[model samples]
Target: MTESIEKIVAELPSLKNVTGAWAVTDERLARGDAVFLADLGIALARTYGSSRQVWQYRSVFDHLLRLLATTPGRDNAVQALRLVGSAEVAGRKLDRYVTSLLASGHEVADLTAVFTGQASEELRACLVHELVLRGVVVEETPGIARWVTSPHWSHHPLGRLPVRLSDVESRADFPNYGAHGSSHSMPYGPLESRAPMVIADARVPSVEETTTQAAAGAMAKAVANWAEESNGRIEARLFVFAEPLDAGSVPEALLTLGLECLRGAGKKTELSVTACAPAQVWRVLFAAASSGGAYNSGSYGAYGRLAAWQSMAALAGCPEGAAVSEVEARVRDGTWHVFDADTEWFEQVAWDIGVAALAPGRRDLAVLAATDTD
Candidate 1:
């Protein structure tokens, strides 16, 4: 990857500008922000021992770079890049370009030109080319640079197969989670026109802190509002992403609290509860599917959604059909169960499929070998 990046920088005459801005990025990364480092570590860990994951990481890294570069000027871009570049991905720095940007004031001016509206078409092309070579800028349209994010663990082993009919969306399209504060939000996809949704941001002061009554009250209010507007059927799916081992009882308590509140509201509420590791997309899907609700697994969540969707789609025996949704609904309706002590076995199978997708001989084609029945 370093060799590829070097080759790109060497070929682009306007490389001076791109390199200088990256130097500022390097300085920021060296400071060691905890959150940034943690995210970087997860991204890199998933990619280790698997080339497919490595490419996925690269795609996301490049997408992040383009976003930082889109900042109005050198300083802002530097700040944005610093916010994301702490990861130890290969070829993060453009060696010669960084040296040139630091040593020559004239080169810094050239780099500034591209971001500050002083660049020529040729220079812009050169910068764009360098980015493309590194997998940062996926496409360029005149003044616009279209960026892309690689799938996260949420979509995993399935690759990028779509669950819904209108799934042509980009992964980099959602608002940043850091921007939304620490509260939880709802409606994993389009309200489905059928499935009731509730996402509880149950983060508390500590593991001993119980917010079951408050969460139940919130859901009751939501159910009441929805009941007045709709046909009055309240089928609520509660997903709890809890942090502590002892905290597992919180979701259990909510089930009782939720049922009691539903009785008062005079509405029949089919409540389904799922508790899993905090901040994981798999648990969210686990909650929805295990509860017999429809799971979208769209661009809004992590990388595992895509992979899960693909695997479910295949297991349902309909590659191009809406079988993924059907299976989710079945799981919600108590027809299928996707979690247990055996889940690790399924995950291992999925990971093998993913590794095979990046086969050394033919990486371009999407092929899954057939099983013999003889």
Candidate 2:
């Protein structure tokens, strides 16, 4: 068996036929041959650059993850994890595997153990970020707390705050901020056909034309990853008014801003709005920023959390080294009034959604609308 595996590894570079390679490996993996799979995983990792295509095979990647989960030997598990990490599966596939490993009781330290050497710290921090975004209960050790709460990580939802296992469990209601379902489908309903009321002194500015560079930068970062992955149009618009809007007019302002941002995407006649708590708003922002708008799937990589925090800080105009409590206080005190809106449009497929924030005192509003058919 060892000789045959070695032969396959040696010939992998010259092999022209993907089917032949799959046939041999898939049959053995189906038979639960852990030894063969483990040996293959190690050899592949040692020569990962050349054997890259072999990892693209789903069966091989799945088998490697299974080995990582069940292998008793720490060395074997580490090797399996390294191989899995080296794979180039598109989108959030790699993240799903990491989530599964964490689910199987593997600690963040256990996974971080594989990434040693000079550049490994960033990799470890990224893994931790992804786990937190996916709603995994991470034990906040001193090292992890520092990594998450560092200035770099503060813009993300849980970054500035202390990470608690209980917080992870309690946040199960995070998705309730917006109307989402188990089917992962967009909530589409009839909208009242009403044109936006043009308030006399209100001004809706293009994202690029925002008066605050920090605000503009934050809005841009918020939708950056989502725009890339969905290959969709995402508009982040800012509305500035001369005076604080009355409670009665907040919804009207949001609807007017939403419609303008959503202009080329077709007509959305009605608007459904729901008020969200500070925590809920932060979670939605973190999820959208971290996971490219597929927050429910746990399919995003490490930088999502980093980008989330940076953007939030920019949006809130947090000073350097601001305390977590201070930032939280600002959010809670209505420096940013958050809400979820469902504009009855883009029913074609997944991830057509809208969210906005109103800074009443600043007389500023930010609206983000995203649509993707693919």
Candidate 3:
């Protein structure tokens, strides 16, 4: 963990380039695997806004890992990791499918056609190996497996395209020092910036672009290494997508960029990047869910900051329309402050009561915001 922290500090530039640069982590409270990923996650969290609860989940996972590892009957850190690692493994599969489609210029879900006869578990294992050695394909999104890129698309002797392949390589912990972002903007666009050639049309000057690239590159490397050392037995991959320079709203964009960066790993993995921050992606996801008190039910790509907003909004009973107006009124009246992650949980909890917008029945939401939220 110390080594990871040192590495994280070294990669601080790239870590800061993330959209939630203001985020923080309590490494002292973390341990085990979660502790290992904390610095990198915290670094990314700062650039990409994240909830303290989500941040705390690292501790939760770490605690579980230690317990699993220490179990006397039949210690099975590997199997117990299934709780989190299984989800990660599934996510990697999603990456392979999406990246393959994008690299081959296939449409979403349409790529499954390529597997009509060949999409076997064995083939998937082989494809996983391929993605481990090449670094050409470029498409990544969070949780959702959508792909884009053409690392394997080269003209054949007959002027025909041969088997399209995506390349990937892993040199985790790349560092960036000069990245810059002030006010925060989320990165959300359609599949226009496909793989092997992702270009964010940020309306920034040349110097800012240079700094953003620098920061982004550094963050990419750190994330890659973290994923490499992470629960690899579970089949995991790392990706990093680019958001508009310093776009504060970073939840979705961060996850998307993370997927893109995974292709950088030396291997041919089929994965794709779905462009969307959180509002649209997550709200829609909730719309598809089976419950309101869903845990980790939202898109891993976006909605990282929803914990804070949802927490405060519920505490104050602030509804969407009139509540927003009331919150605005409070701000104008100096009765409330901008949703700040500047203090302790107790402070935030106490402040919730002062806001007149919070109403009944929303404590469930607030409970999630504080305990199971994020």
Q: Which one wins on TM-score?
A: 2
Off by over 4 Å in 3: 1-105, 108-112, 120-338, 344-363, 367-374
Runs in model 2 deviating more than 4 A are 1-3, 10-38, 45-59, 66-76, 82-119, 130-214, 255-259, 262-268, 293-302, 315-324, 335-348, 360-362
Q: Write the per-residue lDDT of candidate 2 for residues 1-374, one digit (tens) a residue.
A: 32386676677666555456555555664565645665676565565534446644333445455544544444544544544554433224454444334323455555545434222343445566456645654455433555554576555443444443223123322221110112222232123333533334444333223545545656657456556665556566666666666544555556454354443322343334556564555555555554454433433334444454455554554564565455555545554444323343343345554555565374666665655554
- On lDDT, the stronger of 2 and 3 is 2
| Native-to-model Cα distance after best TM-score fit, residue 175 in candidate 3, in Å | 21
Model 1 lowest lDDT segment of ten: 351-360
Q: After superposition, how far is residue 246 of candidate 1 from its true place, in Å?
A: 43
Judged by whole-model lDDT over C-alpha atoms, candidate 2 comes out at 0.48
Clashing pairs counted in every model: 19, 4, 84
Local accuracy of candidate 1 as per-residue lDDT tens digits, 228-265? 33322232232222333123233233323333222322
Arranged by TM-score with the best first, the candidates are 2, 1, 3
How high is each candidate's TM-score? 0.23, 0.62, 0.18
| Candidate 3 lDDT over residue span 192-250, tens digit each | 32233233443431211111333232222212221233311111121222322233222
